[model samples]
Target: MAEAFMKPTVILAMTMGLAVSARTVVAQDTERPERGREGVTAPSGGAGSRWGGPGGGQQPWLPPLWTALDANGDGVIDADEIARAPESLKKLDRNRDGRLTMDEAMSPRPGGMRGPGGQGFEAGGPQGQRPDGSRGNERFAPTTRADGTLDLAMLWSQGRAVGTGPVRFSHPPMRLEDIERITPYGLMVGGHVCPIDHGYFYPRPLTPGQPHFDVMSPADGHIVMISHRTQLTGSTEQQRDYDDYALHIEHSATFYTFYDLLTQLDPAIAQQLDDATRDRFARRQMGPPIHVRIPVKAGQVVGKVGGRSLDIAVINTEVKLPGFLTPRLYGHYAWRVHVVDPFDYFDEPLRSPLLKLNTRKVDPPFGKIDYDIDGRLVGNWFREGSGGYPGDGRDPRGYWMGHLAFAYHHVEPSVVIVSVGDFGGQPRQFAVKGNGPDPAKVSAKDGIVKYELVYAPVNSSGEPIELPPHMRGVQGVLLAQVLENRKLTMEVFPGKTAAAVTGFTTGAETYER
Candidate 1:
């Protein structure tokens, strides 16, 4: 009964792991969590290795679909239990209005956009001073460009731009032919931003005996972090299988690289993973990050990948992108400010093929992520008064409750996505039900505009399928008004239609660019 403007990550990633041919995608996450955690299999097929069939056949940023519909704790949905749809969907309708609203359909996220624990996406600040004019703690922040999207600092200290280090990528992360598709940096899928490249493997539609490839280091650097993890897959016990892995690597303070979907960690560094506690991996979760410092050579193997995709992203601390809008809000995911194209740093011969594999038609072959346009409704917005990335040092409502973005679909830039950190008290994203009153065209003078939210599906190549009535599956409505260029107000009405709502109520929330 309920679908999405953009299907959950797996659904959106058509034939992901089963790569007969290579494809290119656009891509996030600063320092992210492990790729896929082991979890119970879902019967009706969703994201994550095709609903728990095997290794995560997804890019690092395409979050697996987590659902409340897996009733009975059995990880499945049966036909006889079909009657539960209405009631199941109703639970998200907080006010019992018989209709769903944006907030009602969403749930609260503990952290901001990224759930994986880390240092934080934004920099705390080095020359930073406290509001009271007192000296602040030693912190790191990025230097940015005039556009507010990226920075080109020479080196750095505490996330600030000091200057650039001599960063030269020697070896390729993987053999060029080993990859099927290279999802470029800056993608919008599953309602979030992907600030890195997701390299899908070759030999489409993997099997038990599928051959795996080695993930190597691109430069000589010490290992900084490793996401040691395991995942359970299969639709039933008889066919069930599992995978264990450790995804690792990072060059230096100036140049950073990350990998995901690794099935094994090179023995040398595997022993260095910390003795930390971790829950059984689940489809929508990542393993806890293990901190370590191990040196590695440029061509040395760091890990391995076989049945799924391998996520590869390179970040240059020397530069920060301004499109993220509020740097502090994204502190935990620090790399967001400086992510760049690996091709730019790679050795010539090796670099050419990787670039050839890219499918993005954008200006920079690497693709673009930061979309914040100062006075327009086309970028990220933070709730007013919300303390940077963490939030107003208080209750369950943190960065998630205050974060919001009006971005594009990662696959199809033309499709508009209205992402909200909190709507009707929960987090979710949507497409205007009838796909009207575009966010880009609505300015402060537009006053208050109403939107009915619905799911608009896309095709195999990542293009929207405008099937008219089929795409008009209304689930909720949202009321938003751009106060001025940098400020706005919003409210959600679950299970309601645009005509059913007229104005913002007392509960309306205010947001800033």
Candidate 2:
């Protein structure tokens, strides 16, 4: 049976209505001890009040244990109760004295890695036993015997660590319903570029007016540097997409050079350009910088083009690997343009037109995908219908924007690799690989490509695990999807049978392309 824990909010809300106003007793049921904690042992036949007296002790801490164990309304644990107690009760003997004191029973340490008695013992007893084991030393495990009596011993023997106290039982810091905004770190830049006469570049149709889109920056940022006639010194393979239009952008920490944009600009814009920029423009080598932030607003025109699309090429940005230097997109690169559905950013009227074309009606044919068990924002999807093109291209036979793969192992950190590909036939591969930890592996079987990359474990909020530090580990799986309504509807659960695709879902998403 699946176990469920109450959310902190639910627990707090329930306690609010159940709490009773305290009534002042004309005479105290039991005389107050000069100085002692709750659950203190009382002399035999004394007042049977809470605080470990008779009437089945009712101190808030371990009330059930005290009530059940202290049979015949005696506050203290006599030899009879100790004899029938479970093995876990022995752990509360902090001094190794083999007897549980009020202080030891009241205090519970953190859960999970924290074991009983402050020693690294397993949190609970073997399975099939009652819930009396130490689950991370914090809360007690609730258990009952066959006779319907609250079994204090069974709780101690079978308790399993759940989580740290107070914090664990409290409501999560951020609930899923409270969050409204989601951002995509990956962005794609689109524009026209001319092929260099240099070496090692991929083949293109090179049509006179064909537009190119690259999985780079969605838009540009402030210009920080410019160069004129900078010697195109790298070898052809290293400078594959070389453009004399090199200039740096601040927002994305990257560079760009658009070949077709140089001559089209008016003198007003060109006068602001540096001498080097003007000189490069005169030679028809580069264009002025166009800075724009990502998640471009719908209907917001940053530039006007004569063609239906733009051609994007991955240009040169030097990266230093252990053994050598190579050209790559710098910083945290995101291919958002390809991975995100354009409709997500549009207003209802704007998004409505696209939805009508999608054919899913009533709502956009989309869903949100989350991992880490916690409610961390991952990515969104739109069902691939007849009118829609796979925005983050996974369609093997068509021009695709990108491809992503995940590899998982029981032991080793999980790995996620996202790469972009072409619109060609089957058996396509990515031209660039993202930077990740070591021990990554890649393979393919039956047309499905698999890559093993580093994946660090996350917390309840889906952020990387850190508080306990040692709790972090790796996990990964290959993602294979089935599409509909021009969007992704379901994916093959990795590690299971290759053909088994189950579960239906939809939502607005931005990451994990």
Candidate 3:
């Protein structure tokens, strides 16, 4: 199942990490001798490290799906890749049905597109769009050899295997020595209000003219996935858009790391993707994932981030954190289910420095994402019947509007957050009016609990600014009733004070765990 979900990432690993092809390997050997990848080559490991097709052992009933579409084996499907698509796709009628279903389209065998916790791809973004918007976890056609490892010698060459065992990261993803502050893993701020944050954001000091900061590979692995996102900055009339490149590196069959919000890409990495996709990025338009399998070693310069902070996510399918009453609620952003504390994932010396830069002061200073408890208001809630996390199979962007969560502030766990998905017709989060009636203790026996919602301000970098309830202006009032362990009802009166809101309105909506 893990491998099935992994097929979308292999090609991405190649292009974003090491785009220097065999013809340019000699030229790259001297481009920047200081970076440590001179005459770089994917390490030729023993036969034991070979990628054992899908799940490393189990096989599905049908032939691999992507193997049909990406006939040339470059790992992605884009304008440049169109040449090979026709022939391969013509042969994709594996079941002789003359047409393909969502299942058939994602098969490297049926499970290839399976998301975290092994859910179908149907729950993801709109038609033809990769899951998780443009920052998809998976992309590209298979650039892997029969055994699975990307045969870098030739896009489809029968190359030897790579080390597939778990490895310790000898270095941190970024140079933490000069970093300013690292946001907690699950801080619910800005656009990330519910379902929590799946990764951490790294902010650092940049020199007057040197806006680019070096991002590194923490361990030896293949750069398997890359996605280009369109971001806007400034006011409507003067708004400017830029490309935020998100890259995923595969450390082993079971472990991987995702880094995004990058404003710059190393030349070698940039040259790997098709020109069309690259041009889209230049135009500030959402670009699709371009797949490749580039090899990288620990501490290698992966890319560069401008003055903005860098986003990092680490996932290991082998372990599942105990929280999230319904795993399917998180299927659209599926990777949320397998997130781990990055500080804990790293080796000692490296992790210690990273932890020092973190702003969270709690016991697990890194913060937590899985806050759900079956019968409590301290987790996520779904509006009665709105398809939970992935939304109602309509628009993916507004899906979270129906998702509500009663969790703690990511940076300061002491404060309670009453985040509503469709609060007063839109999603918004607020600190409890007086920070009373902690969500962990609130229950059906408590009767109707009145929570005054307020608009918390976040700093320029998107981290919520710590403020007292009295100082933060009140935005509205929320009246909630916990009916049972798994059921509740809530209604909001925007721009109204507690004195103005007396009881539940007919518009009150029901929610469930």
The candidate scoring highest on lDDT is 3
Clashes of each: 63, 53, 19
TM-scores for every predicted model: 0.57, 0.21, 0.64
Which regions of candidate 1 are displaced past 4 Å? 1-171, 188-203, 230-248, 271-290, 347-352, 385-401, 422-427, 433-442, 452-454, 457-461, 464-475, 494-497
| Candidates sorted by TM-score, best first | 3, 1, 2
- The residue-by-residue lDDT of candidate 1 on 245-360, one tens digit each, is 54434455566666766777776665443222122132323322333346689889887777666766666666767676655544334345666766778778777777766655
> How well does model 2 score by local distance difference test?
0.24
RMSD of each: 17.2, 30.2, 15.3
Candidate 1 residue-wise lDDT at 104: 42
Please report how far candidate 1 places residue 292 from its true position, in Å. 3.3
| Model 2 per-residue lDDT tens digits across residues 190-239 | 10001111111112233577543221222333322222222221111233
Give the backbone clash total of model 1: 63
Worst 10 residues of 2 by lDDT: 191-200
Lowest-sum lDDT 10-residue window in model 1? 18-27
